[model samples]
Target: MEETTMLSLLPPALALLMIIATRKVLPSLGVGIIVGALILNDWAFIPSVSLIWEAFSSIFVSEGAINDWELFIILFLLILGIMASLISFSGGSRAFGDWALQRVKTRVGSQLITLIFGILVFIDDYFNSLTVGQVSRPLTDRHNVSRAKLAYIVDSAAAPICVLAPLSSWGAYIITIIDDILSDYSGIAYSGLQAFIYMLPMNFYALAAILFVFLVIVWKLDIGSMRKHEERAIVHQQLLDPTRKNVPGDHSQDLDTHHGSVSDLVIPIVALIISTISFMIFTGARAVDNATLLTIFAETDVARSLVYGGLIGLGASVLLTLSKRPSPFQMLRATWNGIKSMLPAIYILILAWIIVTIIDQLRTGEYLAGLIDGSIPTVFLPALLFIMAGLIAFSTGTSWGTFTILLPIAGEIASVLDLSMILPFLAAVLAGSILGDHCSPISDTTILSSTGAGSHHIDHVVTQLPYAILTAIGAFIGFLVLGMTGSTLGGLLVTLLIIVGIAFSLKSVITPLPEN
Candidate 1:
């Protein structure tokens, strides 16, 4: 492998800064890709152009064949968009909203329901975000909950919940990585599953993030940008900010939504959830002999499974829409409108993927990971590793990639320093990757969370930042305590107290937007 220096950091850093400044994601990602390409080609114009083209093309074709993973993900997104449109046209979303309105009487209840749905869909983060958004949007909107807050709830529940659930796709992937890392050290007695279970308590960020979502909703602790969004929703009945021109996954204007029942929405979503889980099991089972549930998930093709499940869900949605006896023109319009709504998300996703590829070529993650050394104090290792992993994931816009790169380094470091500290170091990396993923504007999960909630992507990113940062502060403190005391319980208790204190303090001083 080629050695990468600090130069690798320029593209993502510039991209992040530009996104914050301009609030324009596409141009920001484009500039980042160009800068990375130029750096790789040493500022040679023609070579850089060629590199950029190659990077873009690689998304569709890799190794002279179709890139199944990327294409499948795109297909699933389109399918989901179409399904959402069909559901709206069939009146299912409206019906479900009315039904929920009768039972969920308060804004808090609606938000809590959204949070509960997020927690239940732990199979995959992508699935969780979109599915939860689809189910919870109508209820939240009816209760005047802002799309930004819904997106925050969806995003918070995604990576954090998936990381903790052993039966989830995230869990399987992490377990595999942990197993590989463990292979290098001979004296370790526990298996990957055992290590993962042991480290669960040590993953302070994920735990804190999940708790933060619940507490924020129950306590009405809206602060910063989130407060502005909530105030608009409550006072003006505007679920979306007026300035947000492009709200992804919004099909309101495109569909009639006046003629169907609750079954129209519930049936398709149920099919999607069941079929996706079935496909995950099926695909995973085919890859391994003597497959246990754990092995099956570990070997599952997540992208492919999503595509398969999406097809089934789309089919169900089409049938439900047809049952409504809409005009042919209405059906076509709904389909087209759904696809159009997702186009923005698709465009952003492709550009994000391209930049991530370019960053990979520059070895940006490796460059970031290489910064860690033995000079760091043993007691500070967990907190430092958490910070380092967060930076790398933030720069790369990929938590799984961060895990792949940093986990081995963490293992090597622990082996040399203190073997018993392996779980803490590994747990810190898990926690930090999630924290960065939540904060990074370019992260796919973050993008999908916005799409799912039908919020302007930048709006979701901005409103969610303070909440993620607050949780991160708590996690950082927890990791510091864990490192010094080596007690997960002590760290967790301190983290909980700190989070509660900060949340209450913010709620007291940050005057909420008053009802008009």
Candidate 2:
């Protein structure tokens, strides 16, 4: 391991290939991390083992991966699942579905509306995915839209939009990380928080996601595995023609479920949202001076929201039981059942975070950071670096891991170049990570969103990639022009125009039919 730059990075790349080829995430991450650690330590057997151990240690060791944000996220998912089960038991979701059907008259309308619903839940990516998927799944199923496609739509919108939204918790985190960079550079006016609020309109990924959802609905253009499922569904219908084939009455999985009042659904969701806001305020997130003292409540938004939602559902169940007068033991059984049902989601979260931990400890990310800094050599390289960062994130299957490793490196590189471009590069890394997370099949959010939508995993992955790649290409062109011109806002404007051009081109390809 007497290192030459290019030669040293080969093992980690091979390991990533191993994971992706097998369609397995955790073991792949483990192998990649172990290989990376070994290389970083020059294959000095004991040190190499120690490096890998450090990676694994974070999962169980003090101040390790489990103790960080991953733990809160897993807990949040568990509580949300519990809340969802309770809502189902209480007939809230069903009631809301019935109300939606009454409002929507056609499949196309429902699909478009479901996309709208995805945009509506904008607080956090995790919250957005879980809420939108659960709410929209029933309607999409009714319309013969594959659950896999729905998952793609939900996942596409969730993280892409969350990072872009100024009002979200993501904005807060990004601002904290890059505050120093913004302050150091006079040209980049507006503080970190204020800049994001304005940049909301400029976020290429977020805009692309929202537009793509609408395009899919309006164009009715099917591609990738989604098209295959759609074709299968169509063929199944045609074969069952009354004149030519014996079509069994409804053999495909039925979307039927109990319908109830909107109050049942609306109450729990509203409670969750309001509770999140209150918790953030209570946690002193708005008060920097008290941030240390408020650390106790800082990460409680997810926990508080889920706990409130669960309790609210329990209260509703109580009211329903009291009106119908069920036995106490029966009620207890139902409540326990609700909690038990979330076990699968809990397991998925834990495994996903562990995989992320493995990827992070590999030290391979540092090599890429070094590579970007070395190769770029000038301010013009940030855009290309951004695209590369996205690719790394996608290949690795973890956005948090990508950001954690890349941000510091990008900052140091910017400092060396004196380009005053750290924030924008950080933005690129953030955006790149989002793009990768959006596209990567192994990404937890992608899988979770698919599961929540009741969609086939591979189907979702294939269908979504085209649109994300299109946006990425458009963003790259815009960023390229930015590197040459040396202007962030100017680059953003150009990117928006490129997106508009794509939208127009898409509109032309998908023309509407005239009435008979």
Candidate 3:
């Protein structure tokens, strides 16, 4: 029953075609799911229809055969919506924006601060994307930063930071995958945790991404589509025209009427941050009978922690609003308004989840992995694995799924080639998956990042593409060198130098926006 034929490619190919044709995500994903269901049920009409219905229904249901992740994503996203609304209506965002403008005066400082903030929240990419986007959008906007650029920073920080942070939810899931795959292999000397650690320095895409953000911010090395967006945003700002509203995610109602203090914004954000970290630690601790900090962190339920944090943050927002003498009904109205603004994003997320389920059912990822399983030259194995993994993740729009499908294959291939090649190959898989996830328009993280930064989804993808490709180029070269030299440290140094050099060379093309 495993997917072995060319027919398995139908669903993803159709999905990609749909996305490119319509520039609309929902209908494309829906059509893809329907086709996948039909294929999965052997083209039987009634069974395929039934499968589609079940998939739709499964998005809200947490129990039973459906993955609990679906429910978690739905609830967490809704809660975040409510929280963002509450913060905005409470005048927290405006206050924070004003406060930030005073302290972070320059464009470079604003961007660097945004990047640093994004890096700090490394626990969960979902949380990182939403929180960083909502909190920093106003601040970044004050400095005339384009929503697309803000989206790029937020998106980059999400998965890339989590992948590198060993104590994050991403790291934990990777650890579990490694354990499952290596359980039967007797010759592998390193533990899953150790192997994961060994692969970290070799995660060139992540290093390139993080460093690239810094380079772009410090050197003003804006290039490609981003430069145009940046120029437009700056021009709009310089005109000081009150009628022009070029900001992307500023969908909220007028904030000029609210006379709330800066604490209104600052306090709720602090509450959300503290609550999320605390709940993560608490959940992780309880999950392990005898737990150290590492064990507790690794075992934490990411979605559940987000739920706890969202509720606490919501509570703080309510209390802060009430303290300002707002009526109870007014508070409710603000909360509802926040939820309403987030409805479009929530709808997109639900559809995305459904399509992912359908893709899983059709075994689209496995089919892609099988294509590169044993056909490549031995010397190019590491680089090839990276490229293959990137393609699978790009096509599927799911990096975690790509990791789950490709890591085991990479591990087995490395074992067959030479025991020493194991970690490098695994590292390649990790790097490639992140790169694909970072760039893919359909990626859940990418979607959420755009939602967070208030940028148009396509705008985010288009603007971020050139930077992501540059990083990928650096990573590919690094993998090639690693495969040839068989040295992790040397490969990493070379990759970092190459990316930095590429970044500097880009400076020659940097053209600042026109002055007022």
Candidate 4:
């Protein structure tokens, strides 16, 4: 209530613990929100009850948290479900899978395709997760690739790629934050864009994540729970393990319903990508007059663009179906069925949003940022900031929020302690935020990726944790080296070697399951 004191941190900590214990995301989030409300209301049960109710309803209040962007995101997810359903109902997914099977014969190739798609959709993480998951799931399923692994690939591709892509939503968002931080310190005259570029090579975690995913594919490296999931899928042809209760949704929908061609799928996917890019440019241009394309991208409203893109994609799917002479009534039914299937994921997303809001109200990120705001040794600042940013992002379940909170603090700390460490510190904060967000079970992108892959949410988290930790280790060491030598190439070399070594060492412990 009064900044992020010890008591204020209790709610999120409790929430994370509950999620780990119960493996139920929604109720765990509710428990956390209630605790936060109780603390805010001075532990009065009746008042806390009312406050909890207010928390849910407040989003709907005029000009409240559920603004146009939020609504667009919600609609986009729903549309994704419908689009996925349409593809299945029209047999496009099945056709595509069949077509893929003829060309990509092995699990490795299937995964590589999924990873490539994830990398291609780099405009936004949200888009990348949904589109890649939907597009690749069928192919992966046919190849006995675990949904957990598919979700991992999708999640890795989404945010990691966006952060590295200079023209992406993540790049724009972080750049703006860095600009604000630069404004306060006259020691440097770097624009947000320039700062982002300067730190790009230093973003070891993001680079490592993308590389590690491909390495996992090429090396067939699976460890921890992920190995078990992969073994089950490949050896037993079991996609969803019966022991897991958190399956996102029923993925056994009719994928062989109609005599649809592969174009039914490809056309909609192409339309979605094209429409999204077009709308992004249009929106960005409207936001500024005579702005360069790159500047327009920096100014674009990604959520709104996604909304239009999803709608256009949906339209294209429907039209493609109609051209094949499907009944209009059948089309409506298919769309509605798809929407219904996504309700579970949507509920989890809404709950996640509410929990994030509660954490924000409690000033969790600010509290964590404040802990490391003061002076520190120059050599230790980069690594310390990375760890701190990761912790805050993990707790709050939002990398963007982590960026907004820590970028300024990192800037101030670097300026006061060692101006030369600025790039590494900023890079550490950015990379750490992505690492934490990737690993956090409550993260929205993680949830979306799980839904897209039709994997159990906790299962996805369990499987992805080890890989995320590996990347974080590389990133931490990279930051340490950067702080000491101020050499980007040296840090990059050390980080890459560490990650590659980890991969090789783990490969011996857990042999990849043989192809069936």
Give the best candidate by TM-score. 1
Clashing pairs in 1: none
lDDT of 1: 0.91
TM-score of every prediction relative to native: 0.98, 0.77, 0.92, 0.96
Candidate 3: segments with Cα more than 4 A from true spot: 42-44, 62-68, 180-183, 237-251, 327-329, 373-375, 514-516
By summed lDDT, the worst window of 10 consecutive residues in model 4 runs over 246-255
CA lDDT of each prediction against the hidden true structure: 0.91, 0.60, 0.79, 0.85
Question: lDDT by residue for model 3 over 213-265, one digit each (tens)?
Answer: 78877877778768877887887662122333332234456343466677877
Sorted by lDDT (best first), the order is: 1, 4, 3, 2
Q: Report the Cα lDDT for candidate 4.
A: 0.85
> 1 or 3: which has the higher TM-score?
1
- Clashes by residue pair, model 2: 58-65, 95-260, 147-455, 148-455
lDDT of 4 by residue, 101-169 (tens): 899999999999999989988988888888888889878989999999999999999999999887887
Residue 495, model 2, lDDT: 76
Off by over 4 Å in 2: 1-72, 183-190, 197-202, 232-259, 285-344, 373-379, 415-424, 442-444, 456-458, 487-490, 493-516
In terms of lDDT, the poorest run of 10 residues in model 1 is: 507-516
Q: By the lDDT metric, which is better: model 1 or model 4?
A: 1
Which lDDT value does model 4 have at 368? 82
| lDDT of residue 506 for candidate 3 | 80
